[model samples]
Target: MKMKLELFLVVMAVVCAAGKPTSKAAAGRNKLLLISFDGFRWDYDQDVDTPNLDQMVKDGVKAKYITPPMLTMTSPSHFTTITGRWVEDHEVVHNMMFDDKTNLKLPHKLTLKKSAWWNKRVLPLWITAQNQGLKTASFHFPGGGANYSGQVVDRVLFEEFDHPDDNETEWRQNIDKVLSWFSEEDFHFVALYYGEPDNVGHAKGPDHPDRKKIIAQIDRTMGYLREAITRFNLNDSLNVILTSDHGMTTVKKRPQVDEVIINKYMDLLKLTSFEILDYGGFGILTPKTGKEQEVFDALSKVPNVTVYKKNEFPESFHLAKSERLPPIVVVADLGFNLNSRFIVYVNKGDHGYHNGEMDMKTIFRAFGPDFKKNFLSEPFDSIHIYPLMCKLLQIEPAPHNGSLSVTENMLLGPEGPAGTEKPGSGGSQGASLSVALLLCMLLFMSDVL
Candidate 1:
């Protein structure tokens, strides 16, 4: 009984040890706030009067634009930034969770709970920081709500599919809440998300008047956020990064051009056993047994659509290597999307286009005590962010695909770690993941027995 008591105390000690600021960079490191506004194009503020974003550019760093992974949809692209892996490696391949065998599908919001799809080996920055003894929170960031290994983000605010994105009042409330987390609760990292502009972009198009209204609202919220940061007295210690998943494109409508609809060319139901189509610029088809060639040939012939067998997918996409993918992949041209299986209402605007397209590029702006002032960077890939975050927090990264050297010049300090430093073993431990896991297992067994 005494031995058990000692073990229990040890376990409690480890639990309590977490969330304390012990960044390898230093004790009491500057807090990081990563904010993502979905579908915010690089040039959205070019014509609009966005004083807050403009102030961010003058106060901190702004990128010409950052590239997202190919097949650039919401969930996959966001996951790419968070995990620092390509689409195939992270395996959060699409906005929808799908089972090729059962032909089952779950939309983006529902898929957040499906950890098997999101956290298959590589963990996000929040988990990595928590393991290194820094507390982290996420508000509506994609994949933030799911469990990774044996842990979840220290704090999370999840949403449903129908949640409105443009609530200015609620947006300020979230800013206040996060400010409290940093000020009163002492969180080292917090990721906030807004579904704006993306929702308005889809329903009313990226260039529509409604999008301008939402942009104005976003700017106003930014003003409130900056003010709240001052009110919380976090101005000296807080570092803020504002970016987006992917940019939006105006979808080609009817009458003016021949809208590329998949069903118009091939009998989709007759071609494949399962499919994930009508979502955006990409689609995956699981061909019926012995009918693989037939499906590939048919989709390939569709004008403005590009088709590939899973193995034949472009290597540059970083998506061809995953076994979780369907046998057949279909890609539509810019300004086009695959639909017709269940076309209810076509979005006036959409993303999931090739990352090379100018319209597909998203914005990047960051400000903090650690970052350089008023520096404008050339374009960089979103993958670089993971390693950059790891560097800022002074935590070892989890063997990611991003390069630290790409963004090193923007920091205030002299370049420290080369991009090739070794990584953590990816368990929830500050020093040694294996030892931590073993201790955790022992605690679990003791409690159960």
Candidate 2:
């Protein structure tokens, strides 16, 4: 009994010692805030009157350009952001994905799984932080806040998909919900995903005047968010990183690649069926049987069309990295577009091809404790965000592919082991917010588990 008491005392002492801070002065030591401004452009705020985003750039490090994926679509880009694993490795190759393994589909819906088996990227930063006992939160990212690793995430804002189309009440509700998350407690790490910019940009095209208004509105909302965090005195410990899924390009003219062309080519050669999938200047062509070369040659004859096979694409593009892709790809030059038989009747801005054209430029701005105060001139991958956060939060990286730690250059403080500090001021604030969100997650996890 005496020996057991001595052992208990020793354990308590160790816990107390571990809980004590190495320096009381390092109060702003443990928080990270990541924000994603959907469809943010390289020069989005150049002419706009976006005060909050402009201030973030002035106060933090802004990337000159976050080069988008060759595919330059939404889900792939977003997957790159959170996982820090490129589509080449993370396996969310495109916006419309068909997982070859397991035959499971990830349609535009939130998924909840028993374990970390669902996501292509093994462990995201938030999950890693949660595993290390660091408090983490997410607000309406593309993939629903399903905790993959069974631990670590403290809160996830539920996305309401009941209304497919945009509603004013629902949009405002999402913003309020996100703001409430930050107001709760000292939050070590928080990620907010705002969908208006991307949603509207796609709906109205990037050139729409409404797009600018939407961008400004979201910026204002971010300002409100910043004010809330400051009002709660959580800014010093917070790092606000703002980025986008992909950039946008205006569609010029839509031209059909023609059934006549396919029929003529087939008559001259041997083939079965030819199908075309259309989106703006991008089109995916599938040839029946193995006559891809004949189909490519026929499509190349079309005015303002350049065709390439999957394997012929550049290695840097990363489009050919996955096998779940069409055989023939079409890229229409500037002021030109391609369409299927159905899309010839419908025309809209789209992004899903590798074009040498520079219109599809994405943007990134990071303001907070972990970044430098000037432009980050270095060309960094969007995937770098994954490991960068890992280093910032000091979490051991979960099993993943190609996410290298960017801590030494990114963080301002000592790069010690993760989650070593006692329950932080942010954790208390986060815990308060976590109470309500935890209940929601429990219900959510129960339904999905």
Candidate 3:
């Protein structure tokens, strides 16, 4: 009987441990560093040499591709990654938002102070981790400064757009700051952002030689970061995830948005107002009351443009359900930009077009103790990253739109049983506890027998 009781206690402990979430820290991996390279295309590494990133893949895991949400703009894509929600759900529908209620226009102007432009509908990972008593930090990451659920990260840095220039000195500083937070302040989670390839990709086309040069420079920065991690003896303790918000596409031509064509059809329409919300790729045309059909019919005839009513937009895009979206959304074909007045020349590249095109797919790679070495995962949506982060940090995620199943295969374990809960379901603490109890009972009964 004494032996049986001892065995029962040991089994109970094992069952209890199995049910609890294991944080990187608890598992002897102390830090998680999320790094973003804006507009890094899925295939950019193949076009140029990225020895540092290549080494990471050799040592860790890589996803084939990460599909961005609809619109595919920088701000929306980054927000989707952090919150694991769609643009409409997060209320940051565009980089520049016009609030009809307050009659205020919020553009993507760089500001250090927090603004009400950010919606609190969903909680980002920083806030979620901080709420669970883990120290968090963010450097120039979108949604970093925003107070979600009345909580901000313990350390925050808002770097300006031009900070990455000057041989990437500011980029190195950002990296140093994040390392300090982990080593000194003991922050468990840190988000770092760099505006690169995207900047050059916009100024010079994605296929341009300058873009390749920029990618190489970014790779060198990655090498620097890897050296720093090793210097601090953090290579084993740190898990670094590198990704991009969206990819770039070359613009071969611009479709003229002829006012004359619209004016010709205006005689038959009762259009109260017409405004273009987004201009380049995913052009949004907000029309006045009851004139959606008239505007759609007119814009449908435009060259290189496809018009869809809000209700008629593609269901796979998950874009039509947002109140913040315009009634008519126009998307230009690949290698084309929408322009008004005359044929505007586009000598460079642009994004924010259709998300279905492969050119819009971005990079996803991770390295550290938790990931599988040299493992290449199938392509997954970027929205699924939030739940993965929550799992890695051992924090209860707020209600989000991501699913653990989407990224479960990327980890170094069994895929396990499928979760019946909906995507972005809140933390499964109750479920975990219930499973723990059942296992405990089963072990106890076996020992008694």
Candidate 4:
């Protein structure tokens, strides 16, 4: 009897010792759901009451501002958030990029079947996680469908089948599908994208009544998502991060501006040697061979616009580091857009301005097992978010520019420096103590017997 009891206690000790490490590893494997509301400005929640978002802020961490990468456009910004690299580093410098190497133009409208436009330089979080044996799903997210480094996400809903619109029911259906994915045992990470407030913000200005209505609708959808997470009891196990690619700003057509200023100079500057890509608020001028000075001299003289030689562009913006960038870049002042005859009507709102502009800032909110509650973080560069995602998922991050230390303070418990104990590991010491006590009790009982 004594021998049996001793053997049992020894086995129990081994089991407890083995189970503790598993628990620690499992604790780090929380589900992460990243949701992007494209063009959702940082202040939209402030302009309209967003109870669901407000509740999330009250329950999770909120950043004061998320400064998007330079160009402040959707594709580049989204890729930046995922890859933690600047436009120059990632090579997806604009929403519509032309690859000179393959002579293939990649527009936002291009199908996922085409992969040449995606940057082969960097690995996105989904690929990183997937490579580490985690299942990842992307729903209509930029770069989600494209295979990076020869590895595509485990599941993807390319833009052709899944496009974002103003329909709340359709949005809910997407959410339902995401929830169902979360229910799957193998689904570990997911990214969801919604084009909202952005679509309406373009048709109607950010402050327009219609825009406000859509913002409210977005808030309601968020509320539904929160309710569903609670209903499924996944609130503590799942992390939901909401952010936007860039914010929108009101824009007005500069009547005949392109014709009077840009067009007139184009003929005089012998612009045939240059490729001028105009994006309403900004333009990129790629001068062929020796025409750089000529293109810069003409556009630089134009009023209400700032022009920079590619090398002279602000280093802080991180825009000029890539050879793919044009020789000259021009940006119009806020509230003004470059005029083009092809445009039927000036968009009421636009982005793609200098990222430092406050109007270009976007939202950042996170709720999950890993984030701190009721904490408001100071403004930080969006590049840092990739490292935060890596930390939360406990995945080894690929080599990138972002530093986890920048955003580590926003997590709960000792996972952050300020916290008293490390997250998930807090229970391990207690578990050890319990096992020791049990061993002691067993030893005492055996001696008595």
Total backbone collisions for each predicted model: 1, 8, 1, 1
The top-ranked prediction according to lDDT is 1
True-vs-predicted CA distance for residue 244, candidate 2, Å: 0.1
Q: How do the predictions measure up, each by TM-score?
A: 0.85, 0.72, 0.81, 0.89
lDDT of 2 by residue, 338-408 (tens): 54543342334555545244556667777665565654645456766676776666677765543454333
Off by over 4 Å in 4: 1-20, 26-28, 99-106, 111-113, 161-164, 254-261, 274-276, 340-345, 414-449
- Residue 121 deviation, candidate 2, in Å? 5.5
Q: What is the lDDT of residue 377 in candidate 2?
A: 48
Q: How close is candidate 2 to the true structure, as a TM-score?
A: 0.72
List where candidate 1 sits over 4 angstroms from the true fold.
1-27, 414-449
* Model 1: per-residue Cα lDDT over 141-179, one tens digit each: 888988887899999888877888888899999999999
**Which of the predicted structures, 2 or 4, would earn the higher TM-score when compared with the native?**
4
Residue 280, candidate 3: alpha-carbon lDDT: 57
TM-score of 3: 0.81
User: Which pairs clash in model 2?
Assistant: 84-383, 130-152, 185-429, 185-430, 186-426, 186-429, 187-426, 394-418
lDDT of 3 at 299: 78
Q: Cα deviation of 276 in candidate 4 (Å)?
A: 4.4
Q: Candidate 4 versus the native: TM-score?
A: 0.89
* Candidate with maximal TM-score: 4
lDDT of each: 0.83, 0.59, 0.75, 0.78
